[model samples]
Target: MREIDRLEDELSPLPESITRIRKLISTLELCHHKAERWVTNIIEAIGEGDTAKGLGTRTAGELHPAERDWRDACVALSAWCAGQPAASVEIKIGGRSASCLLSKLGERSALKEWQVQRLIERIREFIGWPRSMHHGDSVYVFMEECGADFEPPGDAECPEHYREHEEFWKQTMQTRIHDTVNGEAADFSLAVAIDVMFPCNWNFVGNLDIVLGAIGGELYAAQPLTVCARNICHVPIRERMQTVCRTLQCSLQNQRSENDVDSTLLELLGDVTAPQRWLVASLDKTIRLQLRL
Candidate 1:
């Protein structure tokens, strides 16, 4: 028999089970679509920021023309894709265990938390969110793997340091992301797109144009999520946050979930750094990533 036929025969007796699986698959599909919309909105937001910088800068939260365009596009696309089914998986990336749903998958199964982690380790990659980088029940975070002596460039108080270390940050981040996802095209697609759209100069290297093209790679490499949320839920937070930092650095701002922020705040309470006290008052709405139904 053909491979498809053979699998059909194996699956034929489990119609009811298949039906249930199909239903759950449908739910996953919907979630994936939602994730896509979420990511697209995020990207446009970044694009607008860039455009605004060119037009004359604006502070975070102050909407600019480009920003509006991005948000609007995201809203419109989200509306159109509403109710459509997508796929989702819970995987460990960076140092946190979180779920990601996507529009499609090629052949491989969506990884479980541990499996995702193992793969990530094998590849030696890093993304915006570090693997196992969990703060609480829901917040996930990560940062680049800068060495111990990697002193951040900037003023003591205001820090002109960003300019000084910008190149190094980008290069290191690029290596982390690329090294991790090189073999897993589908996973890489989702991740790379998010990376570019968010444009964390703190992690990526090379020219802006190269960074932008990474989005296309993700768009085309898009795949279905095969893993379920339940498979990833039980992973321990400390293990998840292994490489996680108390401070959510530059590129990670775009991906912060509400829970992640709360967790970070809690982590700050225990940290003895001089910056810890300032965080108590720095809680802003923009720092929160709101979840949508």
Candidate 2:
């Protein structure tokens, strides 16, 4: 009885220690993800000519000082984890307890949150940008600026169908959509028409490119005269729509429901302004007719 009591006393502390270890693991995982996102954003910003200095000239082999600091921290943490015992088991009066052991897990040698934040701050400074409160803020700003260049030139020459829906285009530029779905995070500008037409939770729309491409294809079809203005006269509207639909279908094949897709199309057909409603209805009807055929 005494031995059992001693074993129970020893085992009581094990659960708390394991809980602490699990929490540490989760924190480290988040930090790793944050670091990776920062690195990708910096690389993208450099590629887009957003950086003020020649710091963007560095090759992949030549990482910025901030990136090097992050990499070193990761290496040190990995080494420390590798050196620790995989697991430990002990027989005590309370029976047997198994514990996955980690050495120096939260020690000074490990990558700390403050260290990661400091590195990010330094990177922001190097790029002549202020530190953003949100980790994703810098990336979002870069994307928004770059997306402006994606607007097709010569809008003035577009047909009445395309020209009349100027508000839709403006809404697209104004709306800043952000969401995480199927383990992927997407942030982009979306047209207000789309925001209304989307049937399910707008947050579940993971990929904006697919949605935009689908809508653009429809818009292109509605005003065939705009083809000459947009310099896409060579491509048939049906072909373009098919290509967009195929890509969208493939992307959402596994991630989303058919009902969601159908409902969005239905919503597009149902409620909208005159010219835009006509555009959406045409596309929706064409797609359904094609499916039947």
Candidate 3:
């Protein structure tokens, strides 16, 4: 809003009709806030096991004994979605149960968040269940393999062919790295997928986050370490950027896939704030420092 006001005073003046749009925007904001607040209340109620003010609990155990408890929780969510405040969600299950670790989901203190995530995947393998498709929890790593069959984007001969899928081509530039989170379960997958973006790229501020987060997921009870730029003023920004890039490179290599070496980074976008540029001088170093990553 402040930026819009500044722009109106400077480069472009707002038309008198914009006042109506502004009012409409405020109304939309209020409606959004109310919806969010209602959802939050439902989520908290579920966490507390209230399940919509005892609406779900009052129902006797009519569902299959195996899934009775699960149905109880779903009832609240069904009501909400159906406009009667219910857990109106239909989940397709092809396996023995809804999920492998559904029994332990509520009492989750035994496992770390990542462990639960991994165990869920492992259990799904044993039984037929939909695999976890959480992109936020998963890390993506990119790197070049030895004798990598590389193709530069917009190759002189086929520039037109690459135009539509240019971003996809860039993502295909390197193989994504992944190491199994579980040694016992061969089919088990890791949450991290590492790939090399470039050397001397400040965008590693985000890369390191993926690496560290993956490492944390792997070693659930890892010892905490503090990273800080104590003598940041004395250190050159270029050198600092290189340090981040090097850390990321080493970590990605350390976690490189032993089984599947051909996993390419499917992520289409790079960190634009610390963008990878052919020329290092144009890199946005401030984004890395400003975010304090």
Candidate 4:
């Protein structure tokens, strides 16, 4: 069976609530890392003092004493981000613990109190904290214990496209990559469909899948160890950007059938009737396909 079709089949029998819960958990994990980093930066800034302005380049020996100190702090931060792994982020709220290892690089450790406090504040701002916090252990566990929350917008129900989805996002991306390498017709247009839907702030339906596809394509196309400056500044951003851009273009050009990719994307504009699990699954598949390929 086609991998995508297999995924669809596997998801076809699963309950929606279970799928949604799993997806929610995955998202919360991502949020936790984001919160951790934001807090780390704020704490570092405070420690250096006068860091209201962000890190700026300065010649080695050409800064006021305070500026020098700030610069040194900034340098240390760069090193940490480069060196630290994503999984290493840990959030301890009272007695709860939440952590993820996506970007794990070197060691595992907690930050200073000031840093942790700032991270907590950023996280609170991120989820709108206490207000958005659900009362049950499910919500609290993912947050206070897990350290983040990536729940879908509560006001709207999850869409139809995601109805029967299963498998984690990372796995799905790998699968999509494999399909791409195997020369399947779906990968190309799907990638384009995603980029078309979701630009930086462009939140179209099923955008997450497109982003994963683009990432997969880029990673495959680029030289090993290409750096993503905006996402991760340790390496060359241009190469990474180029890879994603190329994937976007490739996806756009390769429609699965006679229909144009743009037209396919537009069909859902007024139609909010589709299952959201499908969208989520598609994205997960796209990402996994890319990595595997």
Candidate 5:
């Protein structure tokens, strides 16, 4: 009944599963509430970031909690909605609700391993954890098409170079995509939309506020994520990192015990440029020395 009453009425501790179920309920409700408020904010403030007027209208100031709750909630919900019962595919956003750098590259894209690593870095940058919205996850990650495209800022290290590309980076950084979600590629732009679940293997969890606009864009967007190379992850950070370690030939294991690994740490291993790659190697060497100790 009432929250206080429920707390007071408890004769004994509830079963762990029940407690988790209650938590799941709370999380989903929170997700719904947050999403609603988020929508409300967008509606009230039509022009925020580098939007095309009322188009990419998300504002930059609002705080977006890590998507972990939604990710965990969806995973648990997926199970409940399935097996014991089943979650019918109520709705889906086929494509265009996502963004990709490699897909855009098709042919020019470098090694497949490089492409995969680049995407993994992007995931680590935006999504903070692993096993998000695992299978039955119920959190909705939204996408803004913003006409044909946009990418995060270049963030060149050189003071002069950074200044050179600074202006262009702003224009390019808008239109955040649910990096892992396979939103449809558009010949023409589509309106903003969101969807959280499908019968897919696993869903992307951490688009964060970082993924979306230049106009009403987020504060985090200005920073670069190593996963983003310069793109998202469901397969896993450790598993993927193991592969990257081999491909790139650097020792990068034990990065948070199979977690998404923090983006700040990931920045050290970034491959954004030839210099960035060199920095990753240098940093990895230093980290390895510490690891052996």
Candidate 6:
């Protein structure tokens, strides 16, 4: 019994790894079961023994394309769960080599090479592993292979009317600012101003509170907008220029402190003050002075 306890002590970490794998397997199995049930219902609806012309001849052993894909994925996941090694093995994460049970599972899984690689990536993500160049490369390659539609709009390719539309929005925002200054609308929040000006940007509306939080001021009341903008600085301004422009314009129009604007915008733009400075310079002198730019 003492020897058995010693073996159990040595394998203490193994149980957690096995539990994780089991949870994943259970999820996959549930999905597979649901898919199977759905496929069975569809086949039954089509009438198994019916020879209806439009319905087509129901084959006794045929599976729908979706069902086939789900089945294959289930099979692959099952094989992986069943083949977990009893011991740890070497694995690379974020370019650093480490010995872990998951790495052992990766090495031992009966899944194909590509399947194993994908599984390892998922496990690494689940374990909160630091991202490496390999992770970036893998994501880039996958996006490319999957034809991800994330290409930035080029200046040359932009519609001729885009400038006109932007100008219209700018004028509208300026008018709104004037109204706010004249006490026409005392309740105008910066979030509302941004949303109104950059109507095309989805994130601005959803992440208004997040953006406001990043700015850091008495604007905490703007928290009930939509999406969290916590890591929006990491997002490319070029991808969402309308929102970016609106934010800068709104900040300037409201005479928000340079320090506050800088703190937030810097996260989105490495040099926070640069965009605001440029924006101020481009605007009328009256507007520039009002913003203390």
Quick one: best TM-score, which candidate? Answer: 5
Q: For this target, which candidate reaches the highest lDDT against the unseen true structure?
A: 6
lDDT of 4 by residue, 52-73 (tens): 3222334544534322322232
Misplaced by over 4 Å in model 1 are 1-62, 84-188, 199-293
lDDT of each: 0.26, 0.30, 0.27, 0.28, 0.28, 0.30
Model 2 residue runs over 4 Å out of place are: 1-19, 30-293
Number of backbone-clashing residue pairs for each candidate, in the order shown: 34, 2, 22, 49, 26, 4
> TM-score of every model?
0.18, 0.16, 0.14, 0.18, 0.20, 0.19
Tens-place lDDT digits, model 1, residues 139-235: 2122222222222222212124224444433433343113122234322222222322321121111212222223223323222222212112122
Could you give the candidate ranking by TM-score, starting with the highest?
5, 6, 1, 4, 2, 3
Q: lDDT tens digits, residues 162-277, model 3?
A: 34544433333322223222122111112212222211122222222333333233323121111122112222343433443333332234433343222222011122111111
Winner on TM-score between 3 and 4 is: 4
CA shift at 277, candidate 1, in angstroms? 37
lDDT of 6 at 235: 27
RMSD to truth, every model: 25.7, 28.3, 25.8, 24.4, 25.0, 30.5
Worst 10 residues of 6 by lDDT: 140-149
Question: Of 3 and 5, which scores higher on TM-score?
Answer: 5
Can you tell me which runs of candidate 6 are displaced by over 4 Å? 1-86, 90-114, 117-144, 149-250, 257-293
* Better structure of 2 and 6 per lDDT: 6
Q: Could you tell me how far off, in angstroms, the CA of residue 61 lies in candidate 2 after the best superposition? A: 22
Model 2 residue-pair collision total: 2
| Tens digit of per-residue lDDT, candidate 2, span 1-293 | 34334543554544443333222222221112132233223222222323222223346456444444333333332333444331332211112111211111234222222222322332343333443424454331111222222332323232343245444444344444443222245333433223222111111111212332333232221111111111122222434344334423422233233432333332222333222222222322333343221
Selected candidate, larger lDDT, 1 vs 5: 5
Model 6 clash pairs are: 206-226, 206-227, 207-227, 233-268
